[model samples]
Target: MSAGVVTRLSTLDRFLPVWILAAMLLGLGAGHVIPGLGAAIDAVQVDGISLPIALGLLIMMYPVLAKVRYDRLDTVTRDRRLLLPSLLLNWVIGPALMFALAWLLLPDLPAYRTGLIIVGLARCIAMVIIWNDLACGDREAAAVLVAVNSVFQVIAFGALGWFYLSVLPGWLGLPQADLAVSGWAIARSVLIFLGIPLLAGYLSRRLGERARGRDWYEARFLPRVGPLALYGLLFTIVVLFALQGAQITGRPLDVARIALPLLAYFALMWTGSFALGRGLGLSYERTTTLAFTAAGNNFELAIAVAIATFGVTSAQALAGVVGPLIEVPALVALVYAALGARRLFSPHVSGSDRVRQA
Candidate 1:
């Protein structure tokens, strides 16, 4: 990318999340004032799916899959430290912490607590890649980590979801038997939101590489798709928040409660992954990449599954929506923090090297 292009991308990276939040606020206001606007927007559906939301998620995931450097997967096996830490943090530690926090902090609200668990159990399948890249993570390592997380999410999400809802909640005091009933619906939503977009992106990249050359694929296509994905994600956020505007307005404090555990989860996971990366003697870029890839949650899948499993109006679904609102801003701060920390600790590494390492 050219200097101007890189600069523009960086600006979008910083602002996209804010823009998403703005769109959500605007949509919420519009939905409230216009009376029927929320229902009208809700009516925009295709094959029992919400078109605007589905389109947003579809485009949002494109950039993530676009960045997957499948060519580098061979090299990933050699970096076992980075790979292992990423897997453990994302799959094991992150989910466990989220489940624990949900039980401990979330009040007796059934839907809200379930939603938090859903968000926690579903590892990030889309925007984690963007955060990882923005943090100046190792691109090759990031690509591999994203792919690995995607696979694990597909295979393990249902089992983990069951554990969090059916088993963990009972251990506390709020046991719910209906948790198992949502599995099939959750699975289908995951397939639609994650599986379809991933396959389409991968196939398109493969075809584009063969027909249009790597330069065209990377320079011409990737840049165009990146912002589109962010816009789509924002649009989805708008619809989601608009639908839940009343609930959000009434339960403002709930957002803070949900955010606290998530913030703690993010800090703990990022720190643990970063420390593990440094202990492994990996380069700064690789360490940063692992830290973020492990820390981020796949809100797209979580939100979709939440809506499907629990009604869109359910508190559980609302909690899933709240996740990104907190995560986006927090992650932006973490990116800056990562950069500064990297510079402070590894002062010998030049700015150019830092960028390259990312």
Candidate 2:
């Protein structure tokens, strides 16, 4: 039997794209039609970070982190077949691929190109979980991988930002782009946006489980807080698009341009990872986890960094915002693609069985 994971989503999740689109339009309209709205939003800042936007980002990250079974990380670490390939895909190949695509596709638009590279550097620590689960992937693997990503994101994101944006391009004889923000600045943004949520989620999971046990934590507590991720995501998008509404509306083709490379990146990454996993003899469920996790970008951290580094109205921020606009639907479609590709694996490897075990 198939996992039927996608069928289990609540109504709000089923029509997520619609709600996001509506939020985008609403923000854009409010920004364009209403004067000073963006300013009003920007005026409220804590330590130079927009308060509302910061809140939304924190909310977006927390529940997803909370859902991770950090305890299972030891198990994942022992599985070098899975862990090694995932590290190579996420940190090395993923960033290099995006850098190449950004330069090739958006050489002229340095701002957006750098923005895309930043997206690549910020690996998915949030929504990949849902995509993995929906694709009937290994749940333990997904949680552990995401936790690994969060840790790597903290330690390496700034350095990768520097390498891709400033160092590597010069080495390749391409026009070197300035990241503008210092490494410390990028680190600060990642720390605030990711670190806070990471600690909160870790603590929540630990304390919640200790107090009421794992069953209540996962079944009762998680379901309540889980939706907050998307809610925070939508809220942040509205605020972001609101700030950049005029610019986004003015340059429709630019958004499309940013999207094309992202589309290529996702397709290439997912397919490549899937093939790699199957060739490595991973089960269908593990392969699906590997593919989705590899394919997904952490747009929450991307947007936060873009906005924190470059103001919300900048083209860089716009590129970061377009990430989820494309990723949500793209990855959702890939979920189905993964489900169909299940037959390609050995008949002995059952996805439903793996899901049940996870």
Displacement of residue 18 (Cα, Å) in model 1 is 4.6
In angstroms, give how far residue 217 of model 1 lies from its true place. 3.7
Residue range 1-358, candidate 1, lDDT tens digits: 2243245345666555577568878866876777777678778986557777778778877776666666666777687877887788888888888877776776566667778777787777666666666666666676667767767776788888777777766776767634443545545666777678777877878999999998898778876776776677677777766765666677789888888888888888888888888888877778888888878887766766777767777777778878877787787677766665665345454221323210
After superposition, the stretches of candidate 2 with alpha carbons farther than 4 Å from their true spots are 1-6, 133-139, 300-314, 339-358
Per-residue error for 75 in candidate 2, Å, reads 1.1
RMSD for each of the candidates: 4.3, 4.0
TM-scores for every predicted model: 0.81, 0.81
lDDT of 2 by residue, 1-358 (tens): 2445445556666566688788878888999999999889979987667888889878877876787778766676788999999999999999999998998899789999988999999898766866786566876688678768877877788778888877888888887766545556555665777678879988999999999999899878988887887788789778877876777778889989999999999999999999999999998888988998899998866876888788777889889988876887788788778877877877664323333111
For model 1, give the RMSD to the true fold: 4.3
Model 1, residue 292: C-alpha shift (Å): 2.4
How high is the lDDT of residue 30 in model 2? 95
Winning candidate number (TM-score): 1
